[model samples]
Target: MPDWATFAGFAGVVLVLLLLLAHASKSAVSGGTPIRGGVDRPQPGSVDPAVAEVHASLTNRVRATGRGTDPTHATQPQLSTLALLANVAVSQGAFGLLLLAGGWFTEIPPSAFGVTAPVLSASTLGVGVVLGGVLYAANEVGASVGERLGIGADEGLREALAPDSPAGWAVLLFLVLPIIAGFEELLFRGVLIGVFAAGFGVSPWLLAVGSSLAFALGHGAQGPAGVVVTGVLGFVLAAAFVLTGSLFVVVVAHYLVNALEFVVHEGMDVDWG
Candidate 1:
């Protein structure tokens, strides 16, 4: 196994990449006309008076609050959301290049990098589906437990997943999420696990645990409970990677979990809103 110092340096590399994405996201856009997706979902208050204000002032003695408290409720262009989309793509791209460069330097085979599925048997796909369902159920229970413990919910992630408008929802569900699932599985499970286990001669299971922790920290914006949930999911995928060496399996599983969240919230109208 590599020394603690060595692992710390490796962690620093991941941190630098994450920090670069975050910084770029902050500076990527300016407040402009309604974003492309905003046409179908205009900022609600922009076109109308505050209904709560009118009601409170004119019709009732009690003061009432409108949707003003939740900025996400209004359909203005969310520069942060746009920036997040760009950051995930750019950061994942960089991660790919880094792995390729490492492969070349280390004289490692491309297959060793875990980019392609070594084998995709029907049994593997079936296992992935079962695992995906398990993750979804576990996350739901974990979230409820977290809330009871006063950890609250991961509103930040919910905002990204469930955009305010139809177009925003389309982009998030179709474009952004697939990319997120593919790239994340590739980076964490394929790349990170391969590097530590092969290059540093670390135990593959230990490397999986390390990558899972990094995955959790990557979602620091979601707070502690959110990190725990993400870490648990990461660990699940990592174990799958170690067993099957099937990139497709983890991607399908990850995508399924994400899709389930959207379906529950948007389609079923469950109250994570």
Candidate 2:
């Protein structure tokens, strides 16, 4: 296994590259040809409705064929295989930094919370049950949200926690999620906290409070109350990540928090009356 330093460096590089590639891809897509010629211009003396319709149809067809509507066509630029590889390399490189930072700083003891299982099977089973319950509750909450939105209530719940898609589901659950969790922890909790703390040179508690609030604001989609809760959670999670130097802990904790909220809202039959 690579050292923590190596992982952090790699993550940082990948993150930078992803940002660059996205920008470049967008630029290339926007640089296509404009539509100022042929049927689009329309004949000067043609007043006939049928003739105008024919011209309009031909103009649309031409545009669909990857020519003229705007000088720049809507079709995305076709990147070469090598370019695609380079883009991936850059993105993955940035992510490496976070992994390295997390690994270098955090330490996980061989035993979790000072408990060790006599049998591997028992440990695995316990983890599975906990994870499953959390996921179930998260799905329920997601379903409720979907119902309110008038979308696919049942499937949306499942899909909300599914991450990206079928082809990458296993990859996401096993690899991508952990990486994201680790990187996010490092960026939001580690770097952000360090920057603010250094700048303020105030009490650590105050630093945590301010940084956590900033973190919550970063997640603007969660609404005001949600943002406030997230901000508090951010402080705790950040401290944990910094203290332990293990992204795995943050990932598990995050999953647990999401699960807990879902269970509280959906599993508990609370009476509004």
Residues 203-228 of candidate 1 have per-residue lDDT tens digits of 88998998898777665444456667
How accurate locally, in lDDT, is each candidate? 0.56, 0.39
* Tens digit per residue, CA lDDT, model 2, 1-273: 323344335434543443343333323222222333322321111111111222233334445676654433322233122222233334433555644445445432222111134423444445534543554454446446644664421211111122233433444334443444444554555444443333335454665676566556544333333344456567776665445434345546554544343234434534121
Worst 10 residues of 2 by lDDT: 42-51
Q: TM-score of each candidate?
A: 0.66, 0.38
User: Could you tell me which 10 consecutive residues in candidate 1 have the lowest summed lDDT?
Assistant: 43-52
RMSD values for the candidates in order, in angstroms, are: 10.8, 15.3
Please report the candidate that would top TM-score against the real structure. Answer: 1
Off by over 4 Å in 1: 1-15, 19-73, 77-87, 90-94, 97-107, 115-121, 164-167
lDDT of 2: 0.39
Q: Candidate 2, 201: how far from true, in Å?
A: 5.7
Q: How accurate is candidate 1 locally (lDDT)?
A: 0.56
